[model samples]
Target: MKLDILAIGAHPDDVELSCAGTLIKETTKGKRVGVVDLTQGELGTRGNAETRTEEARQAAEIMGLAMRQNLKFRDGFFQNDEAHQLEIIKLIRKYQPEIVFCNAIHDRHIDHSKGSQLVGDACFLSGLRKIETIDDSKSQEVWRPKHVYHYIQWYDITPDVVVDISGYINQKVEAVKAYKTQFFDPTNKEPKTPISSQNFLDSVTYRARDLGRIIGVDHAEGFTVERYAAVDSIFDLI
Candidate 1:
């Protein structure tokens, strides 16, 4: 099905952690939203790929996503080459979304930046008529998203756009907590990682709260844009 927005990430929980509130806010308005996980996060310290897959599914349901696809690329070693771009281009053409949310432009994790550039490049390439992609044994038409937004992660990059997700922060938090293995859990004996801390989990809520404070909202999510966002009038922003 055609989507209104498609959020792509380097790992299973990335989208939920970064922009679940924004996505859920859109979905509540009857917009079709989806996710494309570039990897299964096989290399994670706490859980294996199988567990992450299940967690992704639960999170997708929590976020009310219309679709969730995993490209299954290597967890930490995926490249930003033509081959990878073509695969992402196929999804871009197939979904034909108007807005595409991708990994942070720059982040502490190497894969985040890599996936961000790869997906951004693919979005542009997918619009080229001669790129030639096929889905389900039929030729696919080229499609390009009008907007590409990079969700903030690990870093506090200022946002070009912030959406009021006042009523959706709890939903976002639930979706994020769906990844039981990755986030804070006192009972999880697998192993402790940088993200498996109480502070990290609390930060998610406090961060959104702080962003909302800047705009006079209860909660919000921020995204960086590839270009200057435009509106017909200044009041249109309000």
Candidate 2:
């Protein structure tokens, strides 16, 4: 099905940690939004691939997403080549979303940045009619989203735009908590990772609050753009 927005991340919880609040807010306004996880996060120290897939589903449900799909790329070794790009291009053409949210352009994890460039390149290639793709034995039409925004993750990158998500912050927290194995959990006996710390959990909330403070809001999500952001009217900027 066609979606208004498609949020893509390198791992399952990336979308939740970064842009789920914005997704929730948009979906609440009757927009059709979906998620595409590039990998199952199998490399994570805490959760296995099977567990992460289930957690991703629960998180998507918490955000009231229309759909969520996984590319099942290698957790840490996925490359940004023609083979991978074609796969992502197929989905972009299939969904034909107007806007696409992807991983941060640069982050602590190499995969995040790699996936970001991969999706960004796919977005452009998907628009080229010569780049043929097929689905279910039929030729697919070329489609490219008008805007591709990278969400902040891991490191602090100044955002070109901040989306006020004050009303949906609680929902974002809930959606993030759905990944019980990945984030802070007193009961989890697995080895602790950077994300498993309580501080990381708090950072997610406070980071939003901090971003919100910059624009005079209770909570907000930040994003970086590839090019100059355009609005139909100045009133749209806030």
Tens digits of per-residue lDDT, candidate 1, 1-238, equal 9999999999999999999999999999999999999999999999999999999999999999999999999999999999999999999999999999999999999999999999999999999998899999999999999999999999999999998999999999999999999999998898788899999999999999999999999988899999988999999988
Local distance difference test scores for all models: 0.95, 0.95
Query: Where is model 1 more than 4 Å wrong at Cα?
Result: none
Candidate 1: lDDT of 218?
93
Worst 10 residues of 1 by lDDT: 185-194
**Candidate 2 clash pair list:** none
True-vs-predicted CA distance for residue 119, candidate 2, Å: 0.3
* Per-model RMSD to reference: 0.7, 0.7
